[model samples]
Target: MNKHIVIVGGGYVGMYTALRLQRKLGKELRNRSVRITVIDPNSYMTYQPFLPEAAAGNLSPRHVVAPLRRVLPKATILNGMVTKVDHANKKVTFVPGEGEPREIPYDLIVMAAGSISRTLPIPGLTDIGIGFKTVGEAIALRNRVLHQLDVAESTDDVEVRRRALTFVVVGAGFAGVEALAELEDMAKDSTRYYRNIKPSDVRWVLVEATNRVLPEVGPEMGKWTLEQLRERGIEVKLDTRLESATGGHVVLSDGTEFDAETLVWTAGVKPSPVVTEGDLPLDERGRIKTTTQLTVAGTKDAFAAGDLAGVPDVTNPGQYCAPNAQHAVRQAKVLGDNIVRTLHGQQLVEYRHKYVGSVAGLGLHQGVANVYGVKLRGLAAWFMHRTYHLSRVPTLNRKVRVVADWTLALFFKRETVSLGEMEHPRDEFRAAVASNRR
Candidate 1:
């Protein structure tokens, strides 16, 4: 019987691991001795770092995602979710697109289901706040922000205009900071097109529970980021929490209350609930418990990585690996190699890598970075930010397209057109037919 290697989640781990396997085990794959299958809800893997640029209309959404089918031609790609893992019986229960659930037996399993946005139970959050995770959310946020500008420009009522112009973003992490900076820059540039809407009419606010922003970049850089944001007229409230957002009215813990049409939530993320559905051993945070070699604890034929796995950080000693693209990509390589070694009955290597640094884009031609204990800011850091991510964004085709976008942007102006109507394309047609019948 041929060996079946099943990989869950087609994000960085699933895609990269399969890619490495196909390369390393070319002979086994060609002889049909070992088969690989990958299951994921999305057909393409989203490069999450570029989401802020996509939200700001800086990069095309299509170019930021790499289709798994094209990238993993040899591996079987199943567009679905792994609902249950019966690891004891070596079977996995999966739900295909609009189909009945089925059980798949595998000789080896790789769990990398990734994670989802970690939200709070704040009032009206579910209805009003938008997350900055998927590409769809990024596109929706861009349209929503632009639409608010339109509403503010057309409305003469003071209260309505104020609400339309005020935009509040919860959290001061990388996602929130980048999203706020990029959108604010776009809105500032867009004001020239609206005669009645000046740049001063816009109100941008950043709320962080902690005393600083971008904690990954160290305290000095965090303080510098705060200064940069405040210099641009954005209100930065530290050690503040969002009490509630009932009816798009924001109430902060610092006794600040305001009405805003836009509320962006980028607090953090939690492991995918799929982790707990299985018989796998999980840490306190509901992440799969794994050895330093990327193999799940107490399991001989199972492996896990990425945001959903609690892999120890050898460099940090007492801490688990930070859930970031940098670690995910590197861990995937090690996990892939370890799987191959296990097949050949070889010793597995431990995962150990020192922390490098952090880089962030702060709108067009502006950024902040701290690499290898050296700090950088302004245009140089911005260029470094783009250069680094461009090298790490997967395929060459996507890299070229992204570069093309940046190239064209140099000659032309930033596009601020909103296609919010695309969200409900059939509404107009439905209304037209009803009117004609009447």
Candidate 2:
């Protein structure tokens, strides 16, 4: 019987691991010695770093994601969720779209389900706030922002216009900052096309509970970022918490209240709840507890990595690896190599990499980066951000397409058109069919 390897989640870890296995275990796979399978709800792996650019219309949403079938042809791809993992019995329950759950047995399992946006129990938050995690969310946000502009321009009511124009983004990390900066820039640029709307009329607010903005970057860069946002007419409220957002009425802990039509929540992320469903050992933060080798602690023939795994950080003692793309990508490589070694009765190597630095794109031709104790800002940093992420985006096809996009962007005007109808595409068809039947 062939040894089966089942991988959960098609994000960074799942895609890279499957790719590595295909390349490294080609002989084993062809000889029926081993087989690999990947399961994910989406058929594509989204390069989350480019979500801000996608939302700002710098790159097409389709280009930022890699289709699993195209990228990992050697591995069996399942478009579904791993609802349950019976590791003790070497069986996994998967639920595909429009079908009942089914079970499959595996010799080994790789848990890399990734993380989801962390949310709170605040009233009306679920109804109003949108996250900036997936490509769908990015596209939706772009359309929503443009729709808000349409509402502001077409309405004559002063209060309604104010609410429509006010955009609130809760979080000061890279996602929050980049999404706010890019969308704000796009909105500012879009003002020229509207006779009733001006750049000054739009209110962009960044509400961070922490004292600093970009904590990943040093304090100096964080302060500079705060100043830059302030200069760009963005309201930066630090050391303030969101009290409630009931009925689109925002109340902050600082005795402030306001009604806003748009609210983006990019605060943070927690490990996917699927991790808890299994019998794997987990840390206090609900991440799979793993050793330096990326193997699930206290488990046999099981491994975990990426945002869901709490792999010990050797470079930073007493801490686990940060949930970032850089670490996740590097960890996947090591995990794949180690898995192969273990199968061949060879020794395993620990996963360790020193902290490089941080980078953030503020807006068009503006950014901040700190690498190896050297700080860079403005156009230089922006170029560096694009170059670094572009190189890490995965697949030669995607790389070429992204570069093509940037090259064409220099010559053509930025596209501000929103295709929100794509989300509910079947609605029109269903309505037409219903009318015909009537």
Candidate 3:
């Protein structure tokens, strides 16, 4: 029987794993003796760092994701869900093309199902809040923010205008900070075009449950970030929780009330629910338990890594590698090599990496970074943020395109048009017909 390697998710781990494996096992990949298959709902791996830029209309959304089929031509790419995994039986149940789920046997399996947004139970969160996860959400947010300005400017009602102009962002992590900063900056610029709206007329709030924002950076850098945001007129409410957000009327735990048409949720993420669907050993946080070599504990043919794996950071001793693109990219390489080593009967190397510090984008030419004990802020940090992620992004083609986007952005005005209605176009058509009938 031919040896088959089936990777679950086509995010960082799945794409890179198949890419490296095809390269390392060049002849083996085509010999029919070894085959690699990747299954994912989407065909592209999103460069999540650039999502804020895409949301701000600084970069096109299409440029931020690399197509899985084009990147890994040698590997069989399946656009479907890996619903069930029977590792003990060496087969996985999948539903392809809305058909009934069926089992596919494999000699080895790499479980790299990533994470989804971790939302709270706060009232009206699901109805009012927008998630900043995928490209569609990013674009929708951009549209909503810009369109809200239009709504506010055209409206005569003070209450409606106030509600439309207020934007609330939950969480202060990289996603929350970047999204808030970029969207705020865009909205600020966009206000110049609105007759009744000024930047001051808009309210931007960053609601963080913790004392410090951007805790991924140390306390000092985090403090610096908080101050910078406040200086720019963004309300940084630390140690505050959102009590409710019904009908776009947000009530804070600290006795604050606000009406906002826009609510962006970027709190954090937990492991994908797919992880729990399997019989794999999982950590307390629902991440798959794995050895330092990125292989599943006590399972020879089973392996896992990326955001879904509890990969221990040997340097940190007690801590697992944080679910960031930095670790995911590096871990994927090690995982691919380890898989090949295991197949070739060669020695498998343990995965041990240290922190390279953190970097974050804060609108146009603003950013923060704490890289290699060196702290950077403002334009320098922003440049570092772009330069580093550009290099870390999967392919050379993507790197070139992102760099080009940055270069071109210098000579042009940031686009701030909202396309929110694109998400549900039929609503407007239905409303128009109803008005005609009346």
For residues 197-282, could you state the per-residue lDDT of candidate 1 as single tens digits?
A: 99999999999999999998899988998999999999999999999999988999999999988899999999988898989999
TM-score of each: 0.98, 0.98, 0.96
Query: What is the alpha-carbon lDDT of model 3 when measured against the actual structure?
Result: 0.89
Worst 10 residues of 1 by lDDT: 120-129
- Residues 147-238 of candidate 2: C-alpha lDDT, one tens digit per residue: 88988989999999999999999999999999999999999999999999999999998999999999998999999999999999999999
> What is the descending lDDT order?
1, 2, 3
* Alpha-carbon runs more than 4 Å astray in model 1: none
- Lowest-sum lDDT 10-residue window in model 3: 413-422
In model 2, where is the ten-residue run with the lowest total lDDT? Answer: 415-424
Query: What tens-digit string does per-residue lDDT give for candidate 3 at 1-438?
Result: 369999999998888888889899888877878999898999899988889999998888989999998999888988888888889899998888677888989999999888899988899886679999899899989998898888998889999999888999999999999999999999998988888888899899999999999987788889999999998999999999889998888999899998888899998898888888877888887899998999998787999998889998988888889998888888989999999998988999999787889999999899999999999999999999988888878888888888788788889887777777788989999999999999
Q: Comparing candidate 2 with candidate 3, which one achieves the higher TM-score?
A: 2
The list of candidate 2 runs beyond 4 A from truth reads: 427-438
Measured over all alpha carbons after superposition, the RMSD of each candidate to the real structure, in angstroms, is 1.0, 1.4, 1.7
Model 1 accuracy (lDDT, Cα): 0.93
Candidate 2 lDDT at 17 equals 92
Clashing pairs in 2: none
